[model samples]
Target: MSILGVDYGAKKIGIAKADPTGGPAVPLTTLIVANQKEGIERLQQLIASEGVELLVVGVPVSLSQSGAELLRDKDHLNKQMQEVLQFVERLKNTVTIPVELEDERLSTKLANGMQKELVKINGDDAVAAMVILQSYLDRKKL
Candidate 1:
């Protein structure tokens, strides 16, 4: 089954896709939306066209210094995390496919590092999505 990864944001969302048989995820594109509603609409179209069977969304979580546990309380999530959770909820409600959340702590920093090597790169959001998706794929192997 093909899997799609998403790096969600208020304005721009990063997209990545993995092969049906399971392999490295590749950066797809960044969707620039005016609002969450528009983003979901665009995602619906992309999901249908790509024949995505699963949706993986990256959720930013505040981590402790040791990175052993989450730092934020469940009842008091940060603003960004709250927004992402809301978006995920909306996504789950709108799509028929299963939705999964992956912790994306330093995915953006990693993507930015990758940008330094490439002369021309798409938005960092797409790269971040690739990072998130790749991390999920790697963990599944273990």
Candidate 2:
């Protein structure tokens, strides 16, 4: 059994994975989809091919008043959160595996500050998914 992590977005969806042994998470690939249909199809294929038993989806939450800085605006952040939850629900309907959400507040920023070579190869979205997945794995161990 393996676990897959997703950093879902409007334009691009990031992906990462880790073994069931609670090993290090690795950036997989970014899905550049034109619409939700394409995104879901690609995600399904990846999950099947990777033998992912669980799906860890990033759910952005802001404790500070600034909110998700990537979103820039509070209203936009709220709107995006709704869309993300809806997408997650749709994803759950399509897959039999257990789906979970992880807090991804600073994942994108953290990913941006990662190794330059990694960023070049995986892109920010995939790296962000890695960060989100690794966090979950770490918490699971403790």
**TM-scores of the models, in the order given:** 0.87, 0.87
Which residue pairs show backbone clashes in model 2?
Answer: none
What tens-digit string does per-residue lDDT give for candidate 2 at 81-137?
A: 877877887898998898887888899999999998998999999999999999888
- RMSD of every candidate to native, in Å, equals 3.8, 5.1
Among these predictions, the greatest lDDT belongs to 2
lDDT by residue (1-142, candidate 1, tens digit) is 5799999999999999998585789899999999999999999999999999988888887444333354335457888987887898899899999887788989999898885543146678998998989987887761
| Model 2 regions more than 4 Å off | 62-77
**Candidate 1 TM-score over all chains jointly:** 0.87
What's the CA RMSD of model 1 in angstroms?
Answer: 3.8
lDDT of 1 at 23: 72
Residue 48 in model 1: lDDT: 96
List pairs with backbone clashes in candidate 1: none
